[model samples]
Target: MKLKKNITLGLFISASVTALAWQQSGKPESFAVNGNLSGFNDSIVYLTYGTFDDTKIDSAKVTDGKFTFKGRVEEPVQGMLFSRDYKLRLDLFVDKGAVEVRGATDNLKVAGSAIVNDYALFNQEIMANRKWVNNIFTEAWNAKQSGDTARARLLEADGNKWYAYEYEIRKNYIRQHPSSPISARELLMYVNNKTLDECRPMYEALDAKVKASLQGQELTRRMELLSKIKTGNKALSFAQTAVDGQTITLNTYKGKYVLLEFWASWCGPCRAENPNLRKQMDIFGSKGFNVLGVSLDKTRDPWIKAIEKDGLTWTQVSDLKGWNNEIAVAYGVKAVPANFLIDPSGTIIAQDLRGEALNQKLKEIFK
Candidate 1:
């Protein structure tokens, strides 16, 4: 009886810590965001965040560029602040508290919460340190787009150190500040597409309370899921409603080398890769390769239109639920344009092989 009581108490404390991590909140009933955007007047602004269909959390009318919002959050999560016209966009890290904002669209800032400040500071430092790498990457991208592959490769080689240093810097910060929600947040982001072994050290290094936070719980879930998605692991079988209202099943594609693609209609990059993807499909269609598209589109019209416009001839499926699509959540697909290459035996052999990488992999397999 005593052992069971201890276990229950432990669970209770974990839940309590997650709910009350926002200090100075006194476990407040709700959070308030007060803003002063002196550069504009009589406008509408929005505060939006959440993974599962709660994107638009709150909104307020700005009178003379001043507005106020009152809401509650169970844990720390990033929110988006933007005008109704969508011109001004800024990242706001928020939890329960009185968060204050001041300045114009170009210079807006959030204050009155340590976690929020840390989030801003982390961005500033990362940008400042990564400026050189960013320049090189931008130049490389331009070179590649202009068909200057040689120069693009050269620029990419030059930026390799900065790329590695960025990872090192991130790992250092996460280890040094285990208590910060920013640490937990970045750690979770960094773990994307990584193996369980790669993420376990830092995941274990996080503060106990931080690990018990909502994001922490998500991280745990991701790592657990990661084990089953690694190379040599069997592809997870799934069934979903296709765009044409028919049921689609992964088991039907078991005998072919399949590209299980996750994308969305609103993703510009996903659309940009359509022509190249179509070319690959044409070349490899008879060589035991096929493509399956999984869309994260919320509406039917845009989803269907994008398929027709992009000339995507593959079987596409979606639940018309946007980010709330259960398959996306299952795969931890925070962003789109991701894919997994499954072999004939239903084993996931590779992933995210875009552009030239995808071509090279297919060539090696089909050669």
Candidate 2:
């Protein structure tokens, strides 16, 4: 589910880049979307263009089973056509030419630009594979609920197998279509799933034009950030206000072994791990070790309450920006309950330690 959202956002970013580039070049690019929507007449259809962060929306009223959107963009952009009733939605690539979308309102088709067509096909295949995997997962869950352990296990295995198959299909597509924007988008979508080593070759193989796009630049930046945070690298320096309204800096813990922990109140796994973390702090606090907790919560009240409830008495800080936490982003944290174990010299020695693993690492260090 997270992967699906990430892919959609990546595609939006790619299309937004094209629009922005055209805007900056002061060139006029025109687009026409002729949509023949069956079973939907005298209704409104919306055409939205831009990135996930920023967007421009336009609406056209369907008359006589058809609606047309004619506009000029700076460059080719990604857009969505959906009904006012929120029942029908189709992703589109708005390019400098005539585009045709005609089919049942629920099963729309796109035809126009080469990149757009490629992206549509890629999305169609991925969706089909995902649907298959999701069906297996549903069956597995139902079996587990019914106390059929053996059947559940078998179904779970089948789901995993299908998931792996989908992953390979995506990887192969990226490898084979390095010149397509869809390839670049797929690479960006899989960054968190694939390692930097696995992604570099595919990224480098991309066409120069694709590599220079907006999403490409963002992916490159993410790769660089990820590279800097490997196990052997120095911990990135940061400063933020603690929950108590005092300034705290990463270097303040220079002479102590520090566990730089990223978590959030909204994260169930993180909350569940709190008791174990508290135990570690109790054993390690007086032994020249400390924890610097960075909360990715969106507000202060819930964060403070969780800290108090969990009995986490170590240094705590947050910008309260949820997933956009500055320090977490710098550390390449895509998920909560993440941490870096840094030595007194500020070098990261371990990462993502949890439960018994954290305690064992601490024992080894302080024994």
Candidate 3:
């Protein structure tokens, strides 16, 4: 489940992130990953690492429980190694040195760099939660689709609780290891998970070297793009056809408090927040409060169905371009369930508020 080979080039499917060992770094002529598997019947080993633009994968045939990879890396990069069978995976940093891996398929020992160890530890918790939540959510969704509301609710409750727990774990780790490159990677994984003010200081605290790393540079770009839309700035205006075939423009609601929500039909978290939006809409709909939904959904059927099913009795808009929707792209919304609360004057007051937070914000504003 961890290793997914990209079909295009059979490139290494990112194990996403993994934990503990040692960190080393240098400028050797090349990097080597020599692995030893005790009883893995897999005939090949693979290494995967690269940037967003370039994903590279190398394979080595397993011979007598041993495997080796030889390559050159410009910088110490985060990567993963796994068997051709994908039953075993080790998240580690591949630097310009000889990294040795040994042990069974399940428990792997990686030694090469300090960054790799710390990186693994950070991702071990994060990636584990990602998988856990995703798996449970799939079951819950199946239950919901099969008309099993009770089971679905129970599963969703557990998933939500675990998600919060894992998020807390991430916060603690980043705060404790502000200097770790792993922290940078964690933040970059989902910028919408954090507030600009809260995450900015943490980003600033990263070591100079990390800020220059590929992850760091990308994080920097994401943060910079997000900063332009921070609270207190004027909300950007856009227009799209609402779900009901009515054209909706942000400026048309200029004199009302509006929740500019970026969501998708497929996002469970987004769907879960719809009830809260509805509740707030009822309380404030006549009090100059409104919700403008921008969905990152490409299909009309599921998009309309989700809106009607969720009882979102408010204006919703989309370009049917999914992530490529110009409105969503302009807002730099990588994460769904994202929103910006705008005051009557068209200035964003808060962002990504949900549940009790959204309730409280409307309460304070209306009062």
Best by lDDT: 2
RMSD of each: 10.7, 6.8, 9.6
Q: lDDT values of the candidates?
A: 0.76, 0.77, 0.76
* Count of clashing residue pairs in every prediction: 0, 1, 10
Cα RMSD for predicted model 2: 6.8
Model 1 lDDT per residue over 66-113, tens place: 889887766666777887677777777776677888887766777866
Model 3 stretches with alpha carbons more than 4 Å out: 1-35, 38-48, 52-74, 80-89, 96-100, 113-183, 190-195, 205-209, 244-247
For candidate 2, the per-residue lDDT at 114 reads 70
**TM-score, cand. 1 vs. native:** 0.76
Better structure of 2 and 3 per lDDT: 2
Number of the predicted model whose TM-score against the real structure is largest: 1
Q: Scored by Cα lDDT, where does model 1 land?
A: 0.76
Q: Mind giving the per-residue lDDT tens digits that candidate 2 earns over 230-315?
A: 78889999999998899998889988899999999889999899888889878888999898899999989999999888888898
Q: lDDT by residue for model 3 over 1-367, one digit each (tens)?
A: 1323222210111332333232323343588888888988878888897643345899899988898999887666667887666788878877667888888876677776666555554555556666777777888899899999998998899889867766666656665665656677677764652477778777887777667766678889878878888778888888898766888887889788899999999999999999888999999999999998999999999999998899888888998999888888778887788899989899988988999999998999999
Kindly indicate the candidate among 1 and 3 with the higher lDDT: 3
Worst 10 residues of 3 by lDDT: 5-14
